[model samples]
Target: MCIGIPGKIIALHPQQADCAWADVCGMRREVNIALIAEGDRQQLIGCWVLIHVGFALSKLDEQEAQETLAALHAMEEVEADVAMFLGAGEKR
Candidate 1:
């Protein structure tokens, strides 16, 4: 399954504004915001976006982004538990 992470646009490219820097899960990375509307793009300096495969699929409200982040955190917790269990039990 393709996972899309919610992030906030922190910075934009000076020369080519197609791609901008986003703060995702506490980490900053370059993301493409070309898919969104030009009006929105023009004022996306502090907006949340659904980042998928290095591209910004769409813009999201702060509330929605927080909800998605909560879900993602829950899923991550489950994955970490599974990894720990697998590591504890060695394969033959």
Candidate 2:
């Protein structure tokens, strides 16, 4: 399933209007921020953004970002457990 991940904007390429550098979890990468208006672009730096398919869909506050990240981490743990269980079943 496609999920919107929370990422923090770390840098901006003003020369390049559509994309900016973002820190998703611990990894930094370029994310398209074209969905947001040019006037608001300056506010994007150091802000939390909801990302999907390499694009920033929306901006979020710090609290919401933290909560979303925690939930995602929990989901990841559940997925890992399921994979381990399936692997063990296959070996059995």
TM-score on alpha carbons, each prediction: 0.79, 0.78
lDDT for each candidate structure: 0.76, 0.76
RMSD of each: 8.4, 8.5
- Clash statistics: count for each candidate: 0, 0
Estimate candidate 1's alpha-carbon lDDT, on a 0 to 1 scale: 0.76
Off by over 4 Å in 2: 80-92
Model 1 / residue 56 / CA error / Å: 0.4
Model 2 agreement with the true structure over 3-85: per-residue lDDT tens digits: 78788888887679889988876667678999964686778899999988778998899999999878877777667753332
Where does candidate 1 stray beyond 4 Å? Answer: 40-42, 80-92
Tell me model 2's lDDT, rounded to 2 decimals.
0.76
Tens-place lDDT per residue, model 1, 1-92, is: 56787888888877776998888766677788888738656589899999887899998999999998788777776687533322332122
Clashing pairs in 2: none
Give residue 28's lDDT in candidate 2 (0 to 100).
76
